[model samples]
Each structure stands twice: as structure tokens, then as C-alpha cells.
Target: MLELASNLGQAPKAEDLSKSPLSIRGLTVSYGQKPAVFSVDMTVEAGKMTAIIGPNGAGKSTMLKAALGIVPPVSGQVQVFGRSLDEQRARIAYVPQRASVDWDFPTRVIDVVLMGLYRELGLMGRVRAKHRATAMDCLARVGMGDFADRQIGQLSGGQQQRVFLARSLAQGADLYLLDEPFAGVDAATEKAIISVLKSLREAGKTVVVVHHDLATVNDYFDNVFLINTRKVAEGPVAEAFTAETLQNAYGGRLATAQVDQLAKALA
Candidate 1:
């Protein structure tokens, strides 16, 4: 469970700090001269579903990519389970944005999911029967069992998203970082994905999502980290998600009425 108290001004509780699943300090990233993320600091607790909320171009995805070593950071450090990323890569799973993938790669769904086991299977290894079963199980978890034989290009947008999620499930990592998993997905897929995330939390796994929907943040996440080029606010959802913080994060892009509606909902 996430600690409800704000950890903004003070150091994290000693006991909690030592065991945090992900810890980032003074993280800065830049594309040439322009900075995308600046001096961000955050600690994500294990077994909590956390949402990274921010406006467009706020570096929400960039921050996640940086943590995964996909995007090189200008400065700062990230620790996973008190170890470097390379040392703990096997324990982390990443699901990139759907648009980033080449869906027309002429690959079968099960083959794509099997790629998750690459860490276990060396570069020159073969897929055994047990690995196939594991991939199928992951597909079933994401409600994509039936489409396991279909070509990746034939699936609908929601279905493709589900397949990507299944691949992450196949990794069976202790920590998950998902970028825009709900974008352009159907209601049923959304529900199914949330169910999987909740299940991960219940099973003592930590999930961090780069989420866009303000209305569903509290509903889907136990913790929230608001960012806009830097850390704006972070803590338990009920306490960290506020009208003022949303304003700061979105730069007043959200209408006053919209903020009021969310504020009322939270209250």
C-alpha cells in the first residue's frame, strides 16, 4: 500500500526508503539545449498502482523512457530495488506507447509475446513447450488468448494494445512501467487493463503508468505523481491530487469547471 502522507517537503520514512521499488533523484533530461525533465525526484513504493499525470509535452513518457534507459538522461540517477538498472533489468518490464511499435512487422501474436522470455532464453536459444505455455497464459490474462494465432496487423487498435500488455505480462517482472496504455482503447479493454493492474498490485507488484485521464486517476490508482518538466506533487492519490496541483501541472489548460468537477469528485 502507498503511504498517504505527503513526502514532498521531508525525507522519506527511513524504513520505506530502503525498500522502495524505484527511486529517482535529480533526474534531468534534454533534447540538445532544451530540457524535457529537470531535477525530478521520486520514490515509487512497491505493491502500489501509481499514475504519472501531466499535460502534453510534460515529459511524462520521456521520464518513463529515461528510467528504462531508452532515453538518455542529461543527469541524475535511478535505482531499482537498490541496484542499477542493468543489474535489475530482468525484474523490470516496460510497455511502450502503441504508436511506437511497428504493427505491420508480419509477426504472429504468440511470437511477439514470446519475445518477453528473451531475457531467460539467450540470444541463440529456442522456444520450448513450457515457454509457449507461459506466453499463452499471459495472453489469456490480457484477454488476448483467442487472437494468439492472428497476425499483429489484423488486430484492432484496442486488441493491439491488449497484445502489448500481454507481452509485458509474459515478462513476469516485479515492476511494470506502462506508457499511455489507455490511449485510444475501448471501454472493455480499459476495464480489462485496469483489472490486470489491480491484480498486479494485489500480488505485491508495483505499477507505474503514464496516465492522461484526470477523471479516472483516483479511481484507477492508489498513488499519484504529478509532473510538468519536473516534480509538481506526489503522494497518495487522495492527498496529492488536488485542484491546485492539477492547475500547476496543466498550466491552467484544464477549464475551471473541469477542475471543479474533479475537485468535487475527490472531496
Candidate 2:
């Protein structure tokens, strides 16, 4: 139940924690000559579920990529746990969109999950028994323990997402950057994923997700960052999930008549 202003004040003021588990200031991203994200500033708390919601071309995914250092920012800075990306690499995990990977490649679910530990394995290293155990544990966390030997291409869209979730789990990170984790997932799979994310938050891991469905935003996240090229609004769900805010986010494109009717029904 915190506002953006209050949350900024409540955050640790020291340079050490003030840098945040994930922090962005005046962040912007450009693909060639076109700017995808405009100047934006935000902070993600440790052990909380934060959702970034916006329409297509709103730069939600771009902001996430910038945070992960996947897309270099044209301006501003991103700091993780008070350190630069290189220093904080081990403490962060990323679950990219399911469509981002080459599913046609022949690989087992466990093999993909084990890739999370490759950073620790070093170059030209083989998976050891300990790594196998860790990967199994991660699969179990996502309810995919029995599918360890299953081929990645054979899994359903939901199952594929769980596999990636397991991979992030295997990384043993304190911060998770998930891009569209719910896309194309069934309701049951979506609920299961939400449960896992809640558990992660309970375990003191920061989770930042790029989510598109506006109807489920309140139910799914503790904090919401409403973005459309820029940050329109951000804070706890109740305060930021207002008609005026939604209108601002959607602009004149919203069906005002339908919204009025819905508001009257609720009233």
C-alpha cells in the first residue's frame, strides 16, 4: 500500500542498499535510430512481486531487458544489489519469453535447466552430480521433476514455461527478471506459476515480470508499474489501479462508454 513517492523514501537511503536489488534512473533504450524506451526511473524491492503492465510498444519488455543488461541502455544507469551487472550476475536470474528459444533444438528439460549453473561450471566443464541434484530440485520446485528426461520440444507451452522457471530456480538467484511469463499459458498453468512466484517472494527474492493482461494485474502483483513509453503510474495495486490511471495508460483508445457502464454496475 505504498505510493511511488513513499516507496522511494522508504527505500534504504545508503548508497549500499539505495542502489537497490534493481534500480533504474533516467533509463532509455534504442534499437538503431528508433528509441524504444524514454527516460524512466524505478526501483524493485527485494522479496516482492512487481508487475509491469502496458500495451504493445509500451516498452515494458525493453525496461526489463535494460535491467538485465541484455539490451544496453542509451542513457542512465542500472544497478543490482548496489553493484554493476557484472558484479551482480550470480545473484540474478532471467526467464525470457518461451518463444525466444529454439525449441526445435534437441535438448532435454534437465539439460536446459542445468544450463543455469553453467556460470559456476566455467568453460569446458561437465555437469557434475551436485549440479544434477540441484537441477532436479529446481524441476521439483516447478512441479516438473518427473519431466527431467522429457525432450524440450515435446512439452506443451505451459510445460515449456515451467522448464524455464526451473532453470531460473537452479540459478539460485535473489532477483528474477521474467519477460511475459504468462503469455499463451492455460489458466491452471498460470495459477501454478503465480503460486511459485508467491513462494519466491516469501523466500525473499525480488521478482519483476512483464505482464499484459490488465484484468488480472491487481490479483497477481503487489506493486504495479504502469508504463506507456514512459511511467504513467506506479505503486501498490489499489492506489494505482484507478479509472483515471487506466485511462491515462490507455489514452483515448479506451472505450469510455463501456468503462462507464462497468463502473455503474460496480457502484
Candidate 3:
């Protein structure tokens, strides 16, 4: 179900594999004097689902924002499909954490999903009937077609997450950058999102997620990027998602049982 690449090891220094779906080199981010991410480097291969896994405050979400050019990096470069993110904006879709969004915003579920097409619609272009149909189709893909006209605030946490996924799906992008899409969602929603991610890989699209659940990393993604302010390790899940690697990334903060379970899985 997952394709494992042989090159599973620590990220190289300043090497630019721009030809890859996503390439980050020497990326650094700081909040005033506090460094959030320190000279991180990573490469996301095309046609795979890559999980950025680390403990809290490991700069996982910050890295995703930098890749999308949403958060300005103090230094370093981000390349999407061998070009600057701005130049390849149309080829990318981003799903931010649901907590970051204001569910109380006066908007319909369909309207929110249609926002994905705004890039194609432009300021002057009308949405038209086809666009609405497309939006509804995206909702249906996520099992929310029946709630298209409902207010976004009316949906449960899982449904809201699903709606956001539908928006990204409507974008028709080559690469998707999701920031904690699994946070606070129900089990059913988690299952649905995983299915969607697998479908994207089958269609030859790349998906990178800022994920926190180390337990599910292997089950959901083929590739794993472990970071903690600085990159700790990155490669295939089988190779990089090891107890030693997790300890290095989490600073021995993981529970003993977790470490034991990870070791058993590797064995």
C-alpha cells in the first residue's frame, strides 16, 4: 500500500533537489529572539504521503507554513515542483488546522468549499452553475454533500475537518500541504481523510502533513520526517520511524511503552 524509498537517512546539508515535489534548504524561522525552526532541510518525494512527525513545539507546523510561503522564514529557500512557491502556487493546496479558522464566520459549507476555486474564478469571474456543482461534488467526495447548504458553524468537529479537506480536494493541486488535519477529528473522519490521502497518492500527487501521532505515522504515511527545531531524521517509515530516532526527536519524552511498542514494530 505504501512505496518505500531506499534513501532513508538524515537530511543532507544544503543540497537542492528542486526536481522533487518539495525541497527545503537551510530553512530557519524565529519569533523575535526565539528560534522556532533552526536551519531545517527536507525533500518530499513526488507521489507519496510524507508525515512530518515530532513532539509538540518541534516546529512541524512552522515548517509546513514556510513551505507554503505563509510564514516568512528568517533564512532559507522553499521550492515546489522545481520553482518558487509563488511561481507554483496553482499547483499547491493547503489545509490549515481547524482551530485556526473561525467556524462562526458567516458562511455556508458550499461557499467555503467553493473558495478553493477562487484562484480559478478570479475577482471578476462568476462562479456559475458548474462551479457550484463542482463544489458539491467535492463535498460529496468527503461525505458532506447533504450538508452543502448548512452553515459551517453547524457542523461537528469531524465534519468541519472533512469540509476543509473537501476544499483542498476542489483545488485540484499537484501537492497538498496539510497542517494537523487529524487534530480533534472523530475516528470516522480520520479514516476518511486517510482514504483521501491514499487516493491522492494513487493519482500521483504529493501530500505532506504536520502530524503528531507517532503511533499512526507508519499506518498513514510511507515517508516520515522527524524534526525538533532542527531536523532529526527523515526517510522511509520503516527506517526513520525507529525508537532511537523518536527518542532523538522527542528528547526521551515519549512514554516507555511507546518506545517499547516502536521497537517491537521494527523487530
- Steric clashes per prediction: 0, 0, 0
- Encode model 2's per-residue lDDT on 1-267: one tens digit a residue: 001322443456654444368877788888878788889888776677889887788899988887677888888677777666676699999999999989978999999999999888988898889999999999998889999999899999999999999999989999998999999998878988999999999998899999987767767788888888888898877777667777787787668984475344323
Q: Who is ahead in TM-score, 1 or 2?
A: 1
Q: Which stretches of candidate 3 lie over 4 Å from their true place?
A: 1-16
Clashing pairs in 1: none
TM-score of each: 0.94, 0.89, 0.93
Clashing pairs in 2: none
The lDDT leader among the candidates is 1
Best by TM-score: 1
TM-score of 3: 0.93
Stretches off by above 4 angstroms in model 1 are 1-16
Candidate 1 lDDT, tens digit per residue, 1-267?
112122321355445554778888788889878899999988998899999999999999998888778988888777777667777789999999999988999899999999999999989899999999999999999899999899999999999988999989989899999999999999999999999999999999999999999999978999999999989999999889999999899877889999999999989
Estimate the overall C-alpha local distance difference test score of candidate 1. Answer: 0.89
